[model samples]
Target: MGYQELLQNKQYLFWTLQFVGWSGWAMSFYLGIVMWGRPPDNYGFYLPTIAMIGMTITLGLRWMYHLTWDNGLLTRVVAILGGSYGAAVLWMFSRGVIFYNAFPEERKVYEGGSMSFFSYFDGSVSAFWVMLSWSALYFGIKYYLLMQEERQRSLKAMNMAHEAQLKMLRYQLNPHFLFNTLNAISTLVLDGNNSLANVMVTRLSRFLRYSLDNDPMLRVTVAEEIEALQLYLDIEKVRFDERLRLHFDVDSAASEALMPSLLLQPLVENSIKYAIANAIDGGSIAISASVTGRDLELVVADDGPGLDLRNGRLPKGGGVGLANTRERLKALYGNKQSFRLSTTEPHGLTITIRIPLENTTDSE
Candidate 1:
């Protein structure tokens, strides 16, 4: 059973252990008497009576221990030791009363109604150890369970924080992409292309609707993602006209693979901003997806003035899209995913990502 279930139903656990412990003690005492080759005529009755009395005394101890649970360590320790010793004395006195009444001729060590200090003391010596052991086990189990409960709470909090961070990263993309699209539409309006501006506005509304309707926390199939990307490209197409070129090379097997929703939108936006929008002749952007073994690989490459690699690294500034994409991937897949930036062959910049391959069927 899980610790959660055990901790939740502590009353049942206590009762079960209480019954088992006292019953086992009774059985052992009976066996020991039998080994000595001389048992009282009413041993069965006598033994059960003594065990029930011991259980009653321990129940009282359990109540006292619970009452002092929040007390200082020294106070609790004193309560345990004092409670066990006192319980042992009461148990022995009860055992003596029952024994003398059950078999009056057996011995004169304890008189039924007499109070003898030495008689109770001698019997309490052995009983003390049994009560002490019970107390130790009760506290040991209680503390262990409390520790497990604390650990469970910590883990739950951490998972909540992790999910919140992922959502923050996902939300960052929408406004950045929205601003750039609105600027492009503004440019069209300035150039006096009212007809094209109307078309772009229609497409922009559809794209924004798609973005808002779907939750950022959900995953989408590669085909679905590509369709959304087309909505975005349509808006950009009106701005660049034929100067902007696009090509998709998604494999049939990889099209149904699942990835975070809108994961590639920022990367595409980066290509349009840096590569296609800069040069006089514009440039082409290629997006491809393929599955190899257990991994799904995606590539976005643009043919334009690539990164200024004089210092063998990308130039600073204008990297929000790439950086945001990287952080989002890391948040989603942790160490199980990879994102790499490299210079494309001949020219341009390329971003490659590999994540664990998961399909719709696999997720279900």
Candidate 2:
């Protein structure tokens, strides 16, 4: 426990105390009749009254000491001292004129005087049990709180590890995309298309700047991802010219939606390489998104050469980005999200990605 907690809980430790003097109990209004009307001799004495009072004081003092000192050696040492408190109080009552005159005590009450030693024993044993039970309950509560804190700490560490993996994977893109775009840029420059080459270089610069500066695990809005993809297409437009075209129909509802860092780049690159690259006149690529309950259903489609379903295989190193994106969804949203692939109408390829909206925590 912290320092403040100990102080606040002290009221729980030291509050209520019961007082029983002689004849086991007392009442102010009836006190006159109880003591004055009893028979003579030992029956007139108050011994049970003394025993009860002794026990109360002894137990209370021992309880207070246990919480304050809290030492094993001192505990045993103080125990030797506990019964003495009761014994001294019992001794005073046996000799004191006040105890005999106050309460109307029976034969059994007088006999309790002979067994005053038993009161000492009862008080000492009670002190031990009270101290033991209080200590057990206190430590039990503290231990439970410790376990809950430890569990939360573990989950925070796991979340941090997943974030680091995402950031590192986002970094894997530029170098690969750079090499492919540089090849296209070189051809445009060689063909004497200086304006187009400058445009491609500028788009390339913007793409690289976004990849380099933004947080890799950030959830970029769908509008923002489209902007990045358009910049990318602008660079590719320099090389393909009239042969390549793209159709983008983004749903307004899903436009402001969030996505993992560089999530769409790899899928766009995959479609351009395998589908558009093989066609004689290249082709058109379509990107669209729609809301499905608490998730976004997004599709990237291209009208070019399609893959064979029977093979279920990439031509060579064709599936790296798709595989990585698939793994990223699993790491980020687990089973709540989905990724799918299919062949479009007569000759094109289509890839669909579904992400749950609730699990999206990052925003940019």
Candidate 3:
């Protein structure tokens, strides 16, 4: 069992350890007396009485140490040393009193009192070492538990911050797309194209509702995400008409695989903004998904002028959509996912993403 699990039932843990530790010490003490070949006539009763006294004294020491737990280091150190020495003296005196009464023949040497000063001093020295060892173990366990609690708290705080960052990045969809869609609808209405404007408005409503209904923290099926993307593309198709061409190449095996909701929207939007809208004849965008080994691979490519590379890197005006997408992937998958940009064949841009394949059954 884990230390935390054992510590949860502290009363049981303490009593169990206390019984085991003292019993083992008593057994060893008895064995040593036997090995010496001359145990006391009433060694059974005498030894048990001495062990009981030691256990009682150590219990009191435990209580005192607990009271000084939050004190300064010097104060705690002093308490341990002083408390252990005092307990040892009390234990040794109790042992002497029991031994004196049990052996009347040996009492002639100290007929005036129960025990002599020199006897007390010698016994207390040995008892002091045992008491000190117990005290050290108690404090060592206390400090270990304290450190564990602090580490758990630190990890919890980091996870909360990580979640907040991910939510911010997920919700940062392109505002320019919203404004442009509204402008297109306005233009369509003014030109006596009320039917097409109404269609665009319906598609825009569905897309916004989809974005609002799903939580950023949750993943969606590949099929469900594609359905939401279709709503978004419907609005764009109205504005571009024949200028926008779209294709899908999703494997049936990958359709039920799960991915972060709205993950592909930003990539596709970046393609339309940078490649299609800027080109005279517009462009064709192809989105494909397939399962490769243990990963789900997704690709978004467009047939239009690709980004001008400086030192093999995107220029400064690389769209916020790409950056936002990159940040979201890092937050969700850490280093387990990959996002890459490359030049498509015959002059275009291609963005590829690979993430661990998780299916609906895997989630359950």
Q: Top model by lDDT, which number?
A: 1
Best by TM-score: 1
Weakest lDDT window of 10 consecutive positions for candidate 3: 112-121
- Over 157-213, each residue of candidate 3 has an lDDT whose tens digit, in order, gives 988898788777867674767888899999999999999999999999999899989
Question: Which portions of model 1 show Cα errors greater than 4 Å?
Answer: 1-3, 16-56, 99-123, 190-198, 308-318
Each model's Cα RMSD: 3.9, 9.7, 4.0
lDDT scores for all predictions? 0.87, 0.67, 0.86
User: Each model's TM-score, in the order given?
Assistant: 0.82, 0.64, 0.80
**Weakest ten-residue segment in model 1 by summed lDDT:** 109-118
Using alpha carbons, what is the TM-score of model 3? 0.80
lDDT of 2 by residue, 1-364 (tens): 5644543464442232223222233243135545777444443334454445544555564565556555686664454455344445444544344433554453247556664423334444444443344344444544555575687689889889988887666667667788889988888889988887888888899888887777866677788888888888887777677778888888888888887767888888888887777778888889997788988888988877776654433344446787778778888889988887778888777888889763334332
Better of 1 and 3 by lDDT: 1
| lDDT: worst 10-residue window of model 2 | 14-23
Candidate 2 clashes between residue pairs 3 or more apart in a chain or in different chains: 22-49
Q: lDDT per residue, candidate 1, 1-364, as tens digits? A: 7756767788888888889989999999889989989897898899888898998899999999989999999999999999999999999888877776787666554444464534656869899999999999999988887887788899889878877887777677778778878898898899998898899999999998998887767899999999999999998898888989999999999999999888888899899988988879999999999998999999999997777654334456748777777888888888999887788879999888999999999988
Q: Stretches of candidate 3 above 4 Å error?
A: 1-4, 7-63, 93-121, 174-177, 189-198, 310-313
